[model samples]
Target: MPFLTDPVLTAGAFAAVPQPEIPTGDGLLLRPWQASDAPAVYAAFQDPLMHRWQLRAADSAHEVRGWIEEWRGEWATARSVQWAVVDAGEGALLGRVALHHIDLVDGVGEIGYWTVPAARGEGVAARGTSALARWALDEAGFGRLELTHALGNGASCRVAAKCGFALEGTKRSAVLYTDGRQDVHLHARVRGD
Candidate 1:
């Protein structure tokens, strides 16, 4: 069976090239996750806010290494990708940004991000997200990117807005957290926007 429209991006669009490191103008860099980052990632997950929003906490650096391995493997499949947001000067881990749930045929992918406790309030999330969204939508040829966060997360709401992901709508009880189900705000940015 044929479809009415062609895939917005080809299957190997992302896998064809090595994942590139993106520099956020604000002195932050989004780079591929490395095994050496496990300690920082593990420590970041220990923050209460990070633990709460992420819905899981890393028990050990070993576990984080597994995650890094999995994130690296996803690049080969080209279905999902994650980047470690780091300081450009010292390369300290600041946060993470990712394009997940990618659908090449539709040219859409969802964005997810979080900042280390120390990096919060410094605009790391927004800067990193913006850089990745630009790479995904402009350089990588994705037509649209979506960002959804649980309602009442003002920080995340602000990050979404700062990155130009317009609020599309809310999905009631759309996400399950450690506490309970919560409403989710859906934001999006299209290629032209």
Candidate 2:
């Protein structure tokens, strides 16, 4: 009862995805974003660096709260998994890492991250990214994950490298920044790699 071109596939339901708390190196915790963390999220997005790369900007804590709620929806739909990077002792929101563009059937996803200005230069992005990417590939049953950054963003390039993601190639004018279009470097890691 199947078409000749149809490939046999495993069944998956996005609504059944579970969110787990992940611990990272150097006393950092990766967990679901809380309503209370909206203020910190808003503050981090205000950074100049974030503005230069990311397209959306939150103007207030309320908007960030909405963003967090949307992330919860994404989790429920198996569309994406987002984690709030926080300090172990203080529970201070340090950054965020996410596996977006998730395809449950294909077992593939894309990784993205941003660190607060205060947490920059401390390997926070690298550590959190590694933890999240590993979790996606190992525990989450993903076969491949990709991370991309603007070619001019050296810091993000370093983070990807530190997490063992190999440079695949350049995507010409793939990203549109506020200023103009920019070439992006595509980095990826397969489950075994």
Best by lDDT: 1
Across 1-193, the per-residue lDDT of candidate 2 in tens digits comes to 8655532213345456568888986799999889999999999888898999888999899999999999877777767779899998899999999998877667878899998999999898999998988888787677889999999999999999999999999999998999999999999999899
Candidate 2 local Cα displacement, residue 8, angstroms = 11
Instruction: Please state the error at residue 157 of candidate 2 in Å.
Output: 0.3
Query: Each model's C-alpha lDDT?
Result: 0.92, 0.87
Give the residue spans of candidate 2 off by over 4 A: 1-14
TM-score of 1: 0.97
Best by TM-score: 1
Error of 1 at 192 (Å): 1.1
List model 1 lDDT by residue over 12-128, tens digit each.
777888989999887999999999999999999988988678877799999999999999989878789999999999999999999989998999999999988887899899999
| TM-score for each of the candidates | 0.97, 0.92
- RMSD per candidate (Å) reads 0.9, 2.2
